[model samples]
Target: MSNKSEALSRRFEAAFMPNYGVPPVALARGEGSRVWDVDGAEYLDLIGGIAVSSLGHAHPALVEAVSRQVATLAHTSNLFLHEPEVLLAERLIGLLGAPARVFLTSSGTEANEAALKLAIKYGKANGRPYVVAAENGFHGRSLGALSLTGKASIRDQFGPFPADVRFVPYGDADALKNAVTAECAAVFLEPTQGEAGVVPPPDGYLRAVREICDTTGALLVTDEIQSAIGRTGHWFAHQHDGVLPDVLTLAKGLGGGLPIGACVGFGDAGTLFAKGDHGSTFGGNPVSAAAALAVLDTIESQGLLEHVKTVGTLLAEGIASVEHPLLKGVRGRGLWLAVVLTAERAARFQTAAQHAGFLVNAVQPDAVRLAPPLVITAEQVTSFVTALPALLDEASHD
Candidate 1:
């Protein structure tokens, strides 16, 4: 490590919370799909801030839009209106292919929180208060959202959480059918289980869930925080499944690295909140909205949706074709993928990759996750494929 980086690391541990541990490298700068540490070492940023930096680092379009908006109108505090927020709402609703109402927040957790409340309110009015969520599903970490998450390891210590929430196995249509009844308020699902290591549901699984929700008169809420915004070669993963949800929540990549989230309610779910039911102080701030608009506009104009499809296939295929013994297989869509290892050595793989001047995340013991920026190229994907065998070797020997 560089002298500057070591000093910064000492200071960071002293000054900041230890929730995420003391990161070994302090990033100094970033551009495109790469970032440099304070020690002047370049590392390919594969995780993209846990899938937040969709446009990659220092994209000219994102910088310009944020700079211009901050200079113009940064905040209206939700007490008033902002043009960028309105435009973004229209764009999202149009992309969603439905008439919906929008509630903007600061992150995916807040989006899920808002959607949960909306479901509860709507359910209460119709004689239902129970919400069904899928097992191993991750919505957020906030109290209300945590209650809806089916991961017991994270949610156990935080309880007593909100009541009347049930969990069914993800991708199991029969389990979901059994759980979401007329007494259920809504069913929350992640189109793809991201933190569970990019686990995708079985074919027609979403269609079955949709039909179950429709039949049981329960709302369907899909959380697309890490899988949306052109990440899965689609605006929303549920769109690829051809399913319409009553509530859809998004964040992560929405603002291209800025803090922004949205809870969009379709049809009756949209208007569930009254004038005073819910709100956020800095939710729809103009600067973040403008950044999001720039992200959307760039994705559309650059034909990145098609690029994601083509390059993502190459990435998945390349990883699967590798002859490393530690390699098991690959899963996920577009730029988001999980490298399934034969052994539970993800932490060692992560450390090896870091030392090799690459950044990836070990979301599970047997799975190393990769959600690189949408701007990543075929060359970058191939480069990672070529380098991964050495990293796996480093892990295997360790």
Candidate 2:
């Protein structure tokens, strides 16, 4: 770390909790898909803040919407109605092509927590007592959300959660079918498991899960927190399989960078929650709502969804063209791809990529995840791909 970076780290340690440890670089500014550290070192942000920066940094639409909304109206505390909040909810439901009720929150885990509560209530009323989730699936760290998560390492440390939850291996249709029984109230899954190295289930897996949920009279809850909002070339990743979930949890890219989350319930699930059943203080704050609106509008107007598909394909091809022994190929949809590596060199590769002026995430021991801004250009994708050979070489030696 540079002197300036070290000084910032010191200040951060002095004033902040040590939960995240200290970051290697202290970012000073960002524009489009690039960010600069305090020491003036620039980098291409390929991870997009873990798939949250949908429109990239300092986007005009987001800036204008937030600035305009904050200047006009910012908060209502869910006690009063706001136009931006209502409009955002309507827009999201319209995108889903369904009639649903939304419970907006401050983050994705909170959304999942709300969804779990809804499920438990609905199930308790229906005489069901168990919830099923996929192994390696990440919901969040809050107690309830953490319980629903299937990762043993993260969840086991924080338990015991208040909910009775079961886990099945991800993408295993037969295991899921056997696990989700009549006693199961809900089955939670990700249309595409993002944190598990951008893992996508087999084709027809979601449909099978839906069928199982239907047979067992259980609600199908899909966590679209990381895969939704055009991250996977679709508004909702489950839509690619032509299925609608009973409950959908959304966050990450929902506010295009602002902190926001939503638990959207469809059909009977939508009407399950009555007044005072659930609420949030900053849920759907006008400014975040406006920012979300800007993000959706920008995705539609600029045709970034299609752009993501095209550029994402280009990137996959570019990266695959390299014949390095370290390369294991890429897997994912749209901009959410995992560059597979042959060895347990992912953390080293991340460091090398950082040194090479590109940002990526080591989501697993052998997977480097790439979820760049939706506005990232073809040239930027190509640039990252071209830099990978040398980065891999450095990682190999390191």
**lDDT values of the candidates?**
0.92, 0.92
Local accuracy of candidate 1 as per-residue lDDT tens digits, 1-398 = 77898899889989989887898779989999999998789999999999889899999999999999999988999889979999999999998889999999999999999998998898889999799998889999999999988898998998888757888889999988888878998999999999889999999999999899899999999999999999999999998899999999999999999999999999988988999999999898899999999999999999988998999999999999888899999999999899999999999999999998889999999999999999998999888999988988998984
Q: Candidate 2: which stretches are off by over 4 Å?
A: none
Weakest 10 consecutive residues, lDDT, candidate 2? Answer: 151-160
Candidate 1, residue 233: lDDT: 95
Instruction: Tell me the spans in candidate 1 whose CA falls farther than 4 Å from its real position.
Output: none
Provide TM-scores for the models: 0.98, 0.99
Clashes of 2: 0
- In candidate 2, the residue pairs with backbone N, CA or C atoms under 3 Å apart (3 or more residues apart, or in different chains) clash, namely none
lDDT of 2 by residue, 1-398 (tens): 98999999999999999988887779998999999999999999999999999999999999999999999988889889989988999999999999899989989999999999999998899899989998999999989999988888877877778999999999999999889889889999999888888999999999999999999999999999999999989888998999999999999898989999999999899989999998999999999999999999999999998999899899988988999999998899999999999999999999999998998999999999999999999989989988889999998994
lDDT of 2 at 297: 98
Model 1 residue 361 lDDT score: 95
